[model samples]
Target: MSIWQDQHVTVVVSGGIASYKAIYLVRQLMKQGATVRVTMTAHATEFVTPLTFQTLTQQPVFSDEFTMQDPKHVGHVALADWTDLMIMVPATANLIAKVANGIADDAATTTILATTAPKYVVPAMNSHMYANPATQRNLAQLQTDGLQVLTPATGMLAEGYVGRGRMPEPDEIVDWLTQTLIDQQTDLPLHGKKVLVTAGGTREMIDPVRYISNRSSGKMGYAMATVARELGAEVTLISTPTALTQPAGVQYIEVLSAAELLTQVTAKFATTDMLVMAAAVSDYRPVKAVDQKIKKQPGQTGLTLELTETADILKQLAAQKTGQFVIGFAAETQHLLANAEKKLAEKKLDMLVANDVSQPGVGFNGDTNQVTLLTPNSTPVTTNLLSKTEIAHSVLTAAINRGA
Candidate 1:
């Protein structure tokens, strides 16, 4: 299940030009399966209507504490008690001052004061105001009062100059929130574990411009890294060149070629508790790689190049394994189970994830995957076609179970 599934989140919007961005944040939270509620300051209403937020969240927007439509309970108190997490987006200077000074003058501040849930503050204002001693002091006070504050992004502001004090992008805010929530769960399956994951297809250079590589997009491996981090593992993602963003809170290392990947994984293997070999390292490389681009001869029909086998990284790691739980992936075009079982036994893998690349939407650059998990003595587990993220969770879950 997703970390945000069925979670209760309350978003407090204060006055600022960045208040409009709060709508995107709320929608993202909802997309992650969070039940979101909005509480806005009167000044915030000037920038965006309460009805807009109400329509988005499908819940009543709280703007005034005095207006009680529900006779059974106080609005602020009720909402505060219901909230599991509270986020103050575009937290204006005035709002920060009020909260820091215990001034519950509006519906937003009152509920913020009443809620016992963890508070995350994202401040947005002019660069000058953000750098001011008073604003900095209030932010410090929020921290001292046990609130988590996300650093504001620095960029072009509404005041017409490029500087600090831009509210972080919605995706960044959501990522931080997800990591924070995951970090809070001490009982997470992979908590306190160190995991190393390799991703993408390694490139074998044949010339200055030509190279040999696979169709692996690194999506599955990246997904594994993300899920592992969310499960409370300290993750190291060693990847080849890919267009994917690095997962938050992960140690990232970029490398090229099979030799570089081997060097990286070997160096970190001793300290790693779990090793996931998801990279598609090239099996062969040209025996002689030319420094300059190779040119075709006039009227030539073909070119011949000698090839040599690359290092067997999985076999090497398996042989050196002590207490580490090593997992390997098999991307096969034929004899899926038979080949996977042979590789699993040959490499002495603790677990193996196998997928038939010949099937459509099942492998190579796609967002979805259908995998079969194999272990030494257990029945092979086959999963239905699911997103890479879901597949990642399943793979990790199986690993954790095996390790336990």
Candidate 2:
């Protein structure tokens, strides 16, 4: 759900007791990296002060058409021209009718009517008013006018009655709006594509008490999943256990071992348009797992166990791929380029992301990394130290540019 970077969002608050909730909504949008500007109706300011929103957004709040702070440009026109997205929160019945009928009576409706950006409406009012025929007809008109509207949720209302017409909570609103924006951007490269990503280091079982694993904290893979979602892909993240929160808006699968990861990826591979194998799969595992914890021997100095090769996920997926674009990761402490090139060819991957884990803040558990992108017959492109999200964007952009 974390897609809104550099997006210009303009929120219009209308009159209602729910007007105050727009405060949290604006904050949520800004937290997702959006540049938010707020506009309010005169009735709305009765419930919440314009100064509150101005302080939260650190920008001027536009409330009245007659009160112009900038003499050089019409306030509504300038704001309308700058907005990439527009939202009408706590949209009262009066606001809905005005917008549906193209009435520009107040600063809120005037700016909303002037803006060509996609409009998203969230209505809040008495349940009976919401159920009225006029309101329903106006809402349908909004749909016909190509504006997106969120149905008010059902629950206890401010008037102490249980019914629909309550505006959604701040988090819920952000989630809905984020996905609605993604769905509307059909021109996005991965808009309709299904992307399967594997993350974290797989644990190879040794016994009930212990296992073999790596230092991978799954940050890189999670970042990839997040970025893929941002790019408009229907992303499914098959991840090993890691101390990271699951990224919202992506299907997540949890697995502990290399074999489990393989099974999950295989099940989704047939439908996947792109596959990012970011997982650091363990190469070897104990040949036999002890059902119970093994006890120390009294005099034995050393214990020996047989190890077997883990399944080669990349090579296997590469072999079975029909039209899917496969991406593999090479994490090496030494000989980064040489080792990466070898894996790229051997795995028959469409693209390979290679990094030197021995370098500071460059791989595994870290939030940042510097990686080289290798493709067949192309000069390797390496990144400076950057956040994993930035790296993910770089990697996806590279793959897309290469025909992924």
lDDT of each: 0.95, 0.93
Best by lDDT: 1
* Model 2 alpha-carbon miss at residue 365, Å: 2.5
Tens digits of per-residue lDDT for model 2, 1-404: 34688899999999999998999999999988999999999999999999999999999999999988999999999999999999999999999999999999988988998999888999999999999999999999999999999999999899998999999998888878877878878888889889999999999988987999998889999999988987899999999988898887899999999999999999999999999999999999999999999899899999998999999999999999899999999999999999999999998999999999999989977789999999999999999899998999999999989888
Q: Native-vs-model 2 lDDT? A: 0.93
Can you write out model 1's per-residue Cα lDDT over 208-297, one digit (the tens) per residue? 898999999999999999989988899999999999998888999999899999999999999999999999999998888999999989
Model 1 lDDT at residue 45: 98
- Each model's TM-score, in the order given? 0.98, 0.84
TM-score of 1: 0.98
Candidate 2 wrong stretches, greater than 4 Å? 1-6, 15-21, 31-33, 71-74, 92-94, 97-105, 124-141, 152-171, 207-209, 293-305
